[model samples]
Target: MISQAAYGAEPNKDRRIPVTVLTGFLGAGKTTLLNAVLSETSSGKIAVIVNEFGEAGLDHDLIESVEDEIILMQSGCLCCSIRGDLAGTIADLIERRDDGFLRFERIIIETTGLADPAPILQTLLIDPELARTTRMDGLVTVVDAANGSKTLDAQFEAVSQVAMADLILLSKTDLISAKVTDALSMRLNGLNPTARIERPVAGQFDPKQLWGLSGLRKGVRQEDAIAWTTSAPEPKIDPLANLSGLSKPKPVSFAPTPHDTRISSASIVLDTPIKDSAFDYWLDTLIALKGPDILRVKGIVFLEGIDVPFVFHGVQHIFDPPVPLKNWIGDDRRSRIVVIARDLTRPELQRSLDMLRAHQPKTGTKEEVLLGHD
Candidate 1:
C-alpha cells in the first residue's frame, strides 16, 4: 500500500528533496544558522522543522514561517527511531505545498543541540518509510567556542555531534578565550578528521560553510555510532547513543507512558509553581548567558501578576515575549517547561529552576497574586 507519508504520489518522481540535518549542542546556535540561510540562499523554496526538547509543542511558536508551509517540528530529537514518525510531518509539509499552502522546494530538519547525528542520518539511509523520497544532502553541526571543551569532556553527544557533521560550525568564537578556542580546535580535529569547521565571528564568513555534505559514507562504516566515541564522557562521560542521551539521571523514562521519553529530549513539570518575576528572570538570564547553549525553550508559567498564564518561546539567542493563554491548560497549575539542550544536566537544570525560584513570594496563592489583592 502507498503510505500516507508518500503524499499519495511521489513529490518529485525521479528526483528527491535534498534534506540537510543540522545538529549541535542544545544552544549552539543552530536556529540562527537556519535563519542565516534564509538571507544567503535562494534555493528552491526552503522548509525548516525545528525539533525542540520538550513534550508540549513550542518550537512552532518561534518559527517565522515565511509561508505557512514553512513548518517547524517542535517535538523531540529527529535522530531516534521515533524521528521516523515525523514522516507524517514531512508529508504534511509537502502536501501543504502541493495544495499551495507553501512555496518551497528544499527542506531542512534542524535537530536539538543535544542530538547525535547518527540516528538521524541512519533514518535517511535506513528508514524505508522516509528514505524513498528524501535525499540526505549533508549534516551540519554547530559547536560553541566558549564551552566546547567542557561539553566535549562531559557529554558523549558532543563528540558524536562533531563526528557526524559534514560542516562543523564553531559558533560564538569571540566569547571564548583564545587558548580555549585553540584547544577546542585540536579536540575537534582529534575527534573528526573530516568536516569543514567554520568560525562564527570571522568577519561574516560565507554562510555557504554549511552546505554540500553527503549523508553517511556509501558503506556501513558510518553506521557504527558507538565506534565514533573516545571523546564524550571523557572516559567518565559515557555519552549515550544519539538515540536517547541525557547528561544526568534524576528522571527515568518508561516506554509505556505518553511522556514519550524514547528520545534524547524530555520535559519536566515543576511541583512548585514559579512566580512571574522568577520566570522572567529565568528567561532573561538563561537567554543572556546560556542562550547559545540552548536549542529551544518553551513553557506555560503561572506568572505571579498576570491573571492569565504566560507563554514564552525562544530559539538560541533570539527570543519572543510571552503571550497570555486563555486559562491554565489543565488544573495541575504547577509550572511546566520543556527544554531541548545538548549535554545539559538535570542537576544543573534543577539548579537553574531553583535559582529562578530563589526569591519568589510565598504569602498568597496564584489567584491571590494575580488579582492584585495580595
Candidate 2:
C-alpha cells in the first residue's frame, strides 16, 4: 500500500506563507507590472525579490532605501535582490519575519528573463524547510502581445514559461492591433488550455487576483478543481459574409511553430473510478519514463472504494501532497487529468491512461478467488 506520507500528505500546523514566481522572456513588461504592484497603496504588505535591484527601476518615491540588502517601501512592502542562493535568501526573509524584523504577508520572486521556472518550483517542493514554511501560490508569466509570437518561435524558454503558467498576463496589447492580439491569444490558448489569460488594463493589475490560484489548496471546491483540470473549449470563429453575397472569409488560424510543436497539452477523462493500484502504477511508470519531459500534471481523481475524491498536482517529477476534498458532495465521480509535456504526444499519454482503465474491477473476478472459472 502507498502511504499518504509518500505523497507528501500532512496537515498544516500553522499558516504557511504563499509565494508567487514571476517569469517572462526578455522585454515582456514584467518590470512594469512589479512597479505597479509596489507603487499601489492598496497592494498590502508584499516582499518582492529579483535578480538585480538596480534593473528593477526602484525609483518610485513610495520606496525608501533601507540598506544594501533590503529596501523598505512606503506601501508597507519590501524589495530586495537575491544575493546568493534562492533558498538561503528565502530562509533569511523567513527568519527576519519570525524575529520581528520584517512584516509581509506574501513573497514574489521575479526570475531572470532567460530562466526556466520548473527547477525553482521543484526546489520549493523537495526542500523540507521551505515546503513547511511556504506554499506555491501560482506561476505568473508575462507575454508581450506584439512580440510574443516571434519570441515563442525563437525561444523554447518562452514557450515553457507560457506552458507552465497558471495565470498569463498579456502585456503591450495597446501597441498591437486587435487582430494580432487575438491571434496571439489563440496561440497561447493552444499552448496552455488550462491557464487563465488576462490583459492587464493599462499596465495595471490587482495584486489580489494573483493569489490563491493553486487548485490543490486546502478546502478546495469542486468547481475550482474542475476548472483547473479541464481544458478550455476550442474557440468558435464565425465566417464573415460580405454585403455582396460573395464567399465568406475563412477563420484565422495560427500555424504552430517548431518550438510550439515541441510542447503539447492534453486532458484525459475516465468515467469510472480508478483502482489505487492502477493509479500508482500508471503514475509511477509515466514519471519514470518521461519525468523530464513533463512540464505540469494536475488531476481530480476518484479512486475505487474511497468516498471522497482527491486533487493532485505535479511539476516534472516532484509532486505536491494530494489534497482530499472531504467536503465534496455531488453525483460527479469521473476522474480528470491534464498533462502538459514537451516532446510527448497525446496518443502516448492516452496509452498510459489505458493501463489504469484496464485495472478497474471486473465482474466476478473476486468471486473466482485465484481459481479457474471453468
lDDT of each: 0.51, 0.80
User: In candidate 2, which residue pairs get closer than 3 Å at backbone N, Cα or C atoms, i.e. clash?
Assistant: none
Best by TM-score: 2
Residue 25 local lDDT, model 1: 86
Per-residue lDDT tens digits of candidate 2, residues 137-191?
A: 8999999999999999999999999999998888998897655776788788888
Over 4 Å off, model 1:
1-14, 53-84, 202-205, 215-374
Runs of candidate 2 with Cα error greater than 4 angstroms are 1-14, 233-250, 361-374
TM-score of candidate 2 relative to the true fold: 0.89
Worst 10 contiguous positions by lDDT, candidate 1: 365-374
